[model samples]
Target: MTEENRLREKVCLLAKSMFDRGLTGGSTGNMSLRLPDGGLLMTPTGASLGRLDPARLARFDAHGKHIGGDKPTKEHPLHTAFYDTRSTAGAVIHLHSCYSVALSTMSGLDPDNFLPPITPYAIMQLGKVRLLPFFRPGDPAMGEAVRGLAGKRSAVMLANHGPVVAAKDVEAAGNAIEELEATARLTLLTRGMNPRLLTEAQIRDVVTTFNVEWDT
Candidate 1:
C-alpha cells in the first residue's frame, strides 16, 4: 500500500477507537495529519469519529488547497495553526471529550495551565495545556487563539467546548489528548478534597527527567 493509503487507514482506525471509547461522541471531533509531500489528510466535516471513511477523507495540497475527497472539517484553520507555528507538529486532533469540557466550564481555573498537576504521565505527555475562552463553533478566532500561543503548548482546552492537541504523530496526539482528559477527570474527582499534589520540586524533577516543555 502507498503511504497516503496507510495514513488514511490509520486515521480511520484511531478515530474509530477514540469514538468507541466515548472520548468524543457524535460528530464532535476532528483530526489532521501532515502528508509526506507537505499536504494534509483530514477527517471530513460532520462525520462522526466512530464512522470515518478513509477513502472519503479530505485531502489538501501543500499550499492548503483542497485537491480531492469530501469536504474538510470547518476547523481546518485550527489544525493549520499548529502546523504553522510548531515545527514538530505532524498530527492534530480536537475532541469534545466530556471531562475536559466539564473542566473548562468550571470557574477560576488557570487559563495558562488547564490541567492541574495530577499525574506524572499528564506532565510527560502534555507540557502545559492552555485554556482558551469559548468561541462559537467553527469560529476562525479559535485558530487565532492557538496561534497566539506561539507553539509553546502542544495541547489546549477549549472552554465550554473541548480539547485540541498537536503532537509528533497521530498516535502521540491521541495519547496526549487522552492524558489531558484523564487529568481533567482526576481534577474534578479530587476537587475540594485537597488531595496531595506533586510539589514544585517533584514537578521540576518530572519535567527535567522527561524533557517536558514546561513553561516554568
Candidate 2:
C-alpha cells in the first residue's frame, strides 16, 4: 500500500484504540496526520473515533484546503496551529479526556506549566504543558491561544475542555497525550496529600537527557 493509505489506517487504528479505552468518548476527540507531500488526513467532524472509516477521513491539501472526504473537524485550526508553528510536528491530537479536563477546572495551577512534576515521563514526553483559558468549543480563539506559546509547548490543557498534544508522528503524539492524562491523573489523586515530586535538579537532568523543548 502507498504511504498515505498506511497513514490513513494508522489514524483510524490509533483513534479506535483511544476511544475504546475511554480516552475520549462519543465524538469528542480529533486527530490529524501530516503526509509526506504536505497534505493532511484528519478525523471527520461528528465522527466517533471508535468507528472512523479510513476512506471517509477528511483530506486537506498542503495549502490547508479541504479537498475531499467528509468535512474536517471544526477545530482544524487547532491542528494547523501546531503544524504551522512547529516545523517538526507531524501529528496533532486533541482529546476531551476526563482527568485532564478535571485538572483544567481547578484553580491556582501554573498556567505556563499546568501539569505537576509527578512523573519523569510527563517531563520527557511533554516538556511543559500550557493551561489555556476556556474557550467555547470549536472557537478559533483556542488555536490562537496555542499559537501564543510560540511553539515552545508541545501540549496544552484547555480549561474546562481537555488536552491537545503535538508530536513528531502519530504514535508519538498518541503516547505524549496519554502521558499528559496519566500525569494529570496522578496530580489529582495526590492533591492535598503532599505527594513527593521530582526535584528541580532531577527535572533538569531529564530535560537535558531527553532534549526536551523546555521554555524557561
Lowest-scoring 10 consecutive residues by lDDT in candidate 1?
110-119
lDDT tens readout by residue for model 1, 1-216: 999999999999999999999999999899999999999999999999999889999999999999999999999999999999999999999999998899899988998888888789999998888889989988999999989989889998889999999999999999999999999999999999999988999999999999999973
1-216 per-residue lDDT for model 2 (tens digits): 999999999999999999999999999999999999999999999999999999999999989899988999999999999999899899999999999999998888999899999989999998989898999989999998888888888888899989999999999999999999999999999999999999999999999999988854
In TM-score terms, candidate 1 sits at 0.98
Residue pairs clashing in model 2 are none
Candidate 2's displacement at residue 216, Å, is 4.4
- Provide the TM-score for each candidate, comma-separated: 0.98, 0.98
Cα deviation in Å at residue 185, candidate 2?
0.7
